[model samples]
Target: MQNHTIYIRTLKRAEHTVFCVEDGQKTYYDPQFKRMLPYASGQQVKRSLLDSFCDAGNIKISPTTFYWDFNKKKELKEGEAFGTCDPTYPDQLIGGWMKASKGGGSRTLKRRSPLSVSAMKPLHPLLAGVNKDSASFDRSGHSHNKIIVRGEDGKELNEDEINTILEGKDRSLTRKWIPASNKATGLFIQDIAIDLRRLFSIRLDDFEPEISQEVEEKLRESGWVEGENVFGRCLIAPVKLREKLIPILAYAIINWKITSNQARTFSLMETLAVSIGGNANKIAGAIRAKLSEENSEQAIPVVEEQVKGIDTFVTPTAAGYVATTTESIEAMDDAEEKLIEILSSYAYEALPEFAL
Candidate 1:
């Protein structure tokens, strides 16, 4: 709600007042979006422009975001201020280059900054119901506003069609975590209908506090004092980064299936443990003990012969995470139906309202 609600775009000398953008580039300039050059209606300007703007496409187009600032061409005295909002201000300015594509594009609210609006809180349409006072301007209203939009993805939208999405007319849904491959171009990975249910029930502000806390803890735990905050959020400490390489060598052995190597046994165990979300030391210890237990009989060798490494399966760029091997991802996908079936059974078990 604190981003890009009201904008003040700069205007060229004689450009048309209204127009629709295509993937960041303005095209077929018109009256709906752009108001009369120096004089125009803000409401008519919004409606007409939005009508042609949204629809028939996917993925949000980086818009020729509208601004209201008019540069004073009149000669200014030495100490005169041109205007409260100037074209020079970063928020109001748009570069000469950059295309604005048209269509049904996503305008996902990614990040937000602490910006203040007078009584008017410039916000997303989804925010209208939450604060209607300053947002709604009737008879005795002061109409000062501003908006800042950034995302050069160059997709356009048609507001007429967008209304259906906001209106809840299309109430049917897609599942949560539907995967990147299944999503439509402009559609987010999670289906909106499903995801909104979570939003309605969750406190969004606290959703990611652990992300920052964990990264800081990992940094301090590593005993690296300098640049601690700098690299706090990375998965692993910067100094211990090379230690992650130990897993790749261990990974090589797994793919080759050289289970007899006793020295690398701990490494292999540690590597797999990390894969399944366990600490390295705990995994190494568990692997050694498990191997020893299975080898109690003479027929069962202490060396694990069946443990084959799938190297070509994945390419590891960093140590902390495994970029899924096409082979592994494929194998997982093959069994995904069963995996989801199992997961779906347990999905609601631990969820809130289970007792109710």
Candidate 2:
């Protein structure tokens, strides 16, 4: 069984809007460090990864069953027919799922997820910055709700004539505005968000022997054989699943669009490094060393240039040599293509009737 650790550096390209708020503060304050830090929860990152996979057309399962929680009993209540949960579905097998008991019984079945995601946090405290400002908007406006006034002769009357005729009635013009509290400007509300271009680190770790042997036995009964098919191999051996998922996750990280209550449209994150089967602390230490080497205030550009020059490197440790690669977009794309090919092969071989 092989354990792989992936290290990624994210650059906020667009406005990283703030969602968490506490006592009118949007940023998280670490008591140990005594500073407010910019952070993204691991759940958010995992959701984005799942969303990327669901959005991809390479998977045969419906998107609803792929990402969202599905309950057969709940669907039955709505008078909709739904199939039983298949244990061999790629998402269920890799990402894991839960089968809740009916009527709050105690027979809940849950598959533990083998994949672990770390919260996206700042690499260094110095690299993080918070925008402590408020946004103001004018909620005051005017509108003319025109009324069609007709005369007794069935002829439409002009605006002036209509106003004259409806002198005692309500006028078509309407004006609305908030009462100013000793101020002429509109209302201002405060919200905190992390500044753009801040460097953050996220780690993904995959563990082997994810599912129980009993589950594996059931899968084998359903035509799954170790080393025989892609899905089957991934079911019995987690390393194969990790190889297929890591690239897709890399792509997702490069193109993660974080959904927020704030009106932000795009994600500005860029993947700086992706180190597999290596120590994240060592990778992060290397980056921190590079950043500290230069005393210049603008260290991100210099480090980025240095990292771009790095294609592959080996770290010698007690465990042995660990291969690390800072993948490029082209390399990641090629890996994704290879993953699609593998999945297509599995689809064609396992589900011949649904093969395209």
Candidate 3:
């Protein structure tokens, strides 16, 4: 019942990454800002978090629970129903869900997500722009003009013989010339990216009434008593639920991945600086101050400075600073343990009821 509204701010640095696309180009034009900004939409950020949470095994909920639409008449095993199918389903507390009527009626089932993700924006105005690069599809060392066809007799057919056999056939034989390797060189690409060590901001806010009355009624009908089950009580108490979800969000951001043309080969970002807090401006101010320092060597120091005299939580180690997945996971584990210890110190009445 305490003020459940919580605002989380983070500053992250990524390089050579494009967060969105338009007209086959990896950039977005922000009309409000009247400029081309390196940006990621809210939907993009939320989807990444949901996917990361599911992939990392941090949350028990399936990705489909919050995203998939289900047929009411279709047979579903236990826990197979989409979160929207049952309001009381625990995962619905995350992204929420909506299902439209199948018969083309006006009826619909929907729940507003308690979590709000802001479109990621540059912390410094100078951080927004495009980076020019090129990608190649090189097949130079191999033959570019050979077209070997297998005949029905299991023998290779020469181009002349194949053409002669299909002399009058218009449907079966088709041929096109392949450009020489020199002429088929790759083209340049423009990506909206941050190449410098610049800071960017993203805000995640959790607000009041985390669960709807309809959902509460459904939970009661299912024999769920408030304060009995950790899940149930957490759902009813927005602050507690927010605390439980903090680690998952932290993991997602630290292990942040996005849609990029070159993601398959390697991560686009080389290094990152991150901090989390309930006040967006304060966190940004602290980050700016730290970055302005002449002798600062690392980004984690920003977190340390920001958390002073504030209800902010700094990940014990900067998972974002690690180079490999194993290191990232280890760092996150350390962070989660530290967070639990911090929560324990507050002596929240519900602290012992659940393992956040």
- Each candidate structure's TM-score, on Cα atoms with residue i matched to residue i, is 0.16, 0.49, 0.52
Candidate lDDT scores, in order, read 0.21, 0.39, 0.43
Worst lDDT 10-window in candidate 2 = 182-191
- lDDT tens per residue, model 2, 267-328: 33433333221344443433331244556443232122234322222121201211233324
Which regions of candidate 3 are displaced past 4 Å? 1-3, 20-26, 29-35, 58-91, 100-107, 144-218, 221-223, 226-250, 259-265, 268-271, 288-308, 311-356
Off by over 4 Å in 2: 1-16, 19-26, 58-85, 99-108, 137-142, 145-218, 226-250, 264-266, 289-356
lDDT by residue (tens digit), candidate 3, 250-336? 455455455554352233432233333344455455344223355333222233343552333323333443222222424434444
Residue 82 Cα positional deviation in candidate 2, in Å, after optimal superposition: 14
Best by TM-score: 3
lDDT, residue 64, candidate 3? 51
- Candidate 1 vs candidate 3: the lDDT winner is 3
Cα deviation at 293, candidate 1, in Å, is: 29
lDDT of 1 by residue, 215-319 (tens): 345445655232211112212223233233223212221221101122211122111111110122322221121112544321211111122220111212211
Whole-model lDDT for model 2 versus the true structure? 0.39
